[model samples]
Target: MTRTEMEARVRELLVDLAPEFEADAIDPDEDLRQQLDIDSMDLHQLATSLFEVYGVDIPESERADLVTLRAIVDWLDAHVSR
Candidate 1:
């Protein structure tokens, strides 16, 4: 998928994972956990969701790289096949 579509999908996943937060208001460069008040469980859920959606497996060792929306989109862009 394109980067724009990846970002939109990420936002949709974020909204599903944390409905209390406004996904559209998220700062792409900010730390997702802090910005959205999400915990490790939520992060794991996000990783799982991404894997299910894009067939990209984000190992536990690399979860830290998923700190921001931009980062997640970039990671998916790099790993996911068109």
Candidate 2:
């Protein structure tokens, strides 16, 4: 997928987990957990959902690497096979 597509997917995932967060207000550079009020459990669910939806593996160790929406989209772009 293109970078734009990846970004949209990540935002969609964030919106799924945090419905209270307005999609338009999401800051790509902001820490998703802090900005969206997503707890560890929510993040865990996100990881699982990503794997299920995208077939991308996000090991527990690398969870820290996906801090923001932009980071997650970029990471997935690099990790996922074309």
Candidate 3:
């Protein structure tokens, strides 16, 4: 998928998981756990939800790379793209 599409999907996954936050307000550079009120469990849930949404299996070892929205986008672009 293209980078724009990947970014959009990441935002969509976040909104789907947590509707309280303004999807548009999410700073791609900001850490979701620290900035978005998402906890560690939320991160795990987010990862699982993202895998379900994108049909891609993000390895457990790479979970550390998903700390921020930008990171998630980069991870998906690198790992999920065909």
Candidate 4:
């Protein structure tokens, strides 16, 4: 899928994960933690959900690399086969 498609998918995942956040307010370029006030546990849970949904594993060591929406998209883009 294209980057734009990946971004949209990521957004969809985030929306499903955090129903408290207004979908339209999520900034694709902003830090997810800061924008959404998500805690570490919430982040871990979200990552796990993403992996389950996409069938892609994200190592714990690299979890910090996914600090923003763009970062998650980039990680998936790099790890997922075309």
Candidate 5:
């Protein structure tokens, strides 16, 4: 998928998982964990949810790379299966 599509999907997943989060307020460069009030479990859920929707393996080693919205988009652009 294109970067635009991936970015939108990432935001959609975040909102789907955490309805209280301000999806539009998420900073592209800031760490989302700190931007929002979610805990570790919430992050795990986010990763798994993204994997389910994108068919991507967000391995524990690579989870750190998904800290920000821009990072998620860039990471997926490189890792997503065609």
Candidate 6:
């Protein structure tokens, strides 16, 4: 998938996981967890959801790379098949 598509998909998943927040308001460069006030479990759920959707496994060692929206999109763009 394209980077824009990946970003949209990620935002959709995030909004589903955290309904209090709006997808469009998410700052791509900000720390998602901090911005959303979500915990690690929420992050795990996001990774799981992404894997289920795109079949891309984000290993625990690389979870740190998923700190921001842009990072998640970039990570998915680099790992996921188009």
- Score each candidate by Cα lDDT: 0.87, 0.86, 0.80, 0.82, 0.80, 0.89
Model 6 lDDT per residue over 1-82, tens place? 5788888999999999899999999999999878999898999899899989999899889888779998888888888877
Q: Poorest 10 consecutive residues of model 4 by lDDT?
A: 16-25
Tell me the tens digit of each residue's lDDT in model 3 across 20-57. 88778899998787777887777777878877877778
Total clashes in model 2, counting residue pairs 3 or more apart in sequence or in different chains: 0
Comparing 1 and 2 on lDDT, the stronger one: 1
lDDT (tens digit, per residue) of candidate 2 on 1-82: 7888878877888899999887778999999878998999899888888899789888778888789988898889888887
lDDT for each residue of candidate 4 in 10-80, tens digit (9 for 90 to 100): 77778777888766678878888888888888887887877786788899899887888988988988888
Q: Which candidate is the best by lDDT?
A: 6
- Residue-level error in angstroms, candidate 1, position 53: 0.4
| Residues forming the 10-long window of minimal summed lDDT in candidate 1 | 57-66
Looking at model 4, residue 70 earns an lDDT score of 80
Work out the TM-score per prediction. 0.93, 0.91, 0.84, 0.83, 0.85, 0.94
Backbone clashes in model 2, listed as residue pairs: none
Could you tell me which 10 consecutive residues in candidate 5 have the lowest summed lDDT?
17-26
* Candidate 4 Cα errors over 4 Å, as ranges: none
How far in Å is the alpha carbon of 61 misplaced in model 4?
Answer: 1.2
lDDT for model 5, on a 0 to 1 scale? Answer: 0.80
lDDT of 1 by residue, 4-72 (tens): 878988999999988987868889999988889899899889888988998889877877887999988
Per-residue accuracy of model 5 over 6-82 as CA lDDT, tens digit each: 88888888777678876786778888888776678988888788778878777889787778889888888988887
Segments of candidate 6 deviating more than 4 angstroms: none
| Predicted structure 1: lDDT | 0.87
User: In terms of TM-score, which candidate is stronger, 1 or 4?
Assistant: 1
RMSD values for the candidates in order, in angstroms, are 0.9, 1.0, 1.5, 1.6, 1.5, 0.8
